[model samples]
Target chain A: MSIQIEELCKRYGDKVLFEHLNLRVEKPAVLWAPSGWGKTTLLRILMGLEQPDGGRVTGVGRVGAVFQENRLCRALNAVQNVALVTPDGKGDPEAIRRDFGLLGMQGAALALPTARLSGGQKRRTALLRALWAEADTLLLDEPFTGLDPAAMQQAAALLRQRCAGRSALLATHDRAAIQALGWPVLVLAGQNGPESGGK
Target chain B: MKPVWVQRAAAVLFWLAVWQCAAMAVGQEVFLVSPVAALRALVQLLPTADFWGRVWFSSGRILLGFGLGAGCSVLLAAASAKIRWVDILLSPLMQLVKATPVASFIILALVWVRGRSLSILISFLMVLPVLYGAVRTGIQSTDPQLLEMARVFRLPRMRRLRAIWLPAVLPAFHQGCSVALGICWKSGVAAEVIGLPDGSIGDALYRAKITLSTGDLFAWTFVIICVSALFEKLFLWILDRAVKRVTGEEAAR
Candidate 1:
């Protein structure tokens, strides 16, 4: 029902990243942290890609993620890329195509390899892949990078719709995207609460 | 402003002309044969059932050896990439295979395997180290970030291979295959020459040599080149199609 991170500690050499960092998420939320402040690192740890120096994560079952990079299979089209994480990799093709269309990816964008996609299109594809994936928790790192204002708003709306009732953490520095999603913000380098206006 | 293919053809014609001039200068049938004579000899051999039988025998064995070697190398490379101890243990053996001469391997293999299988053994040995090194490097060079992404999404092993590993590994594997194809053909034919397998292209070559029929010898050499080139093209074409199927390139298009 919820994801819990307890007393997590991570560091690089002498640079302290997180000392006894703790957070919990019951619904879709924003992780607001400055660049080089280990937001990506924290998300990677949550996604089980990296091990924290200390502490254990609990209740993170069946995670889906949008990594810092788009990370779509370059040879696959947007629809096929989304289908890759689906149950038995058999997501409904029409449904994936419709979702891509909704995200303003129509015609060749849906058919062409993600390698040929623009940065925003690729970012949107990555978002859809994570949302379409079979998972209870979602970790997205800078999910709005390279998106225009309209596309960012569309993506935020999609994130809101998909992440409802699921424990999700979207790490981004985009203030506009934060306000668009209107999710509670957890500041990584400062306080770990929903107090800031994401500025 | 000639087309690239036209340019290539012109270059080939120039080389043939130079070869023809050199043959005329040598003026000894035993030492040199004109390209025209070789082509004439090839035309004569084309209608003969015996020539086709020899072609089939050598081609089948060599192709089998190449296939076996390619398959084993991929498996071994995957193993070496995944397991550090396997890499450590296999490093020396692969290096040894690479360093050893083809003649030595063919001669040594004669004592172990019959002459019929000598070409296969030599070709297999020739391909093993080259492809093993290539596919291993390809596997090792897989993008860590993509792997992490796959892990997070919990992609099944087969899906992971199709989406991530195969694409990363294919280019290097293809290059390795190209190199191995040429190597296997050279060594396979050489092994046949040494072993003198009955009714083989190598035996025909030996007979031509003993009889001092330079035209037949040149024609047989030309036949080997043509067959090897044709097989290389055909194999690479199939591999490309397989890659497209695995990566869903056709569906994407």
Candidate 2:
């Protein structure tokens, strides 16, 4: 499945965020943009959380997203948070535990409430939640925000393994992360709209 | 420094002392009863079968009313949040209930409801609007960011409810219940005093008033305060546990 955006336009009161932006997601890709370049807004629109000022996007079916903010339920533990997005909330405990362990989360960190988790742990929880969701497309916004270099590499590897054969877009400006994934890059250039590039 | 509970106990003793002095200065048993006299009256009443009977009679009916009110308010609040027409219809009615006086409702309800069920109906009415407002506000104010995440992930209805909605709304519900519990007891007993249901605590209170037994009045008032506080604590504790179980947070732990 592919997502196609046609002449999408969005703007604030005076500042324009997106102007005639167009892009496609036929494979997993990286959305590379400088800070304040409206990458988050584009992802929000794609996730159907916001309405575009003018344009059409098609083939964006059931979506899974890792928000800029780690949106894990504060009262739920890391495992429970991942299970929350599964169909009927019936994720297998063993598989989830193994996945957490792969991302360096185990024991007390996995069982404690997300509120008590460190920033890096929370980000991993958010990523795992999206990966576990029964969704057709994935939209990740700065998914490795607080991760250290080692954790970032682990998360990148996890994302690559889970996102295979699925339409995914990882929005980040981190050069190291962009190189880590080595996926096609869709750059959101201000005013000039988006420039598509391939690795 | 002493513990917080000890400080609170000291404060309570100081107030009791002030009350005792005031009662002695009045110098009339008909006008006032000292703390010791009220305690003595409480001790005398506790051993009697009738006292427990009256306590149970009032407590059971009032609690039933509270439970019913709580259930209906949650359902109605959800409906109001989901449907615009429901909110439009129920908003004014809830406002009117809040504005109307408890005594007026007790008197007006006397025409429609039997005397035995009067306290139950009164308590229900007293709790409904408060809880409805709290639940509605809670639902309305739920974090939009979390809601967006749920939608994007296509989380199922029940999962979204347990994970997102319950935690958002629980604090408000707890606050509402705290405020509603006291009103439920006060209005229920007032209804009983006015309706004079057979063998209710309010009936005894009415009898105490007619007989000019100030000690009985003080003793019954003390009992009401204690019971109300205890019920609030128990109800809130159960609510927290139930929410934890439903959300699978307890199982994860």
lDDT to native, each model: 0.89, 0.89
Instruction: Evaluate residue A179 in candidate 2 and report its C-alpha lDDT on the 0 to 100 scale.
Output: 88
Model 2 earns a TM-score of: 0.92
The residue-by-residue lDDT of candidate 2 on B1-253, one tens digit each, is 9999999999999999999999999988789899999999999999999999999999999999999999999999999999999999999999999999999999999998988899999999999999999999889878888887887887778878988898878878888999999999999999999999998999999999999998999999999999999999898888778877876554321
In candidate 1, stretches whose alpha carbon ends up further than 4 angstroms from where it belongs are A191-199, B250-253
Residue B156, model 1, lDDT: 89
lDDT of 1 by residue, A148-171 (tens): 999998888888988998999999
lDDT of 2 by residue, A1-199 (tens): 8989989998998888878887878999998887887889988999998899999898889888899999888888898888877876869978999998998888888889899999999999999989998889999999999999889999999999988998999998788998888788887766556665853
Model 2 chain A weakest 10-residue run by lDDT: A190-199
Docking class of 2: medium
Per-model chain B TM-scores are 0.97, 0.96
Clashing pairs in 1: none
Q: Judging by TM-score against the true structure, name the best candidate.
A: 1
Q: Compose the digit string of candidate 1's lDDT tens values, residues B1-253.
A: 9999999999999999998999999998789998998889999999999999999999999989999999999999999888999999999999999999999999999999999999999999999999999999889888887898888888889999999999888888888988999999999999999999998999899889999999999999999999999999888888888989888764311
Quote the lDDT for A182 in model 2: 78
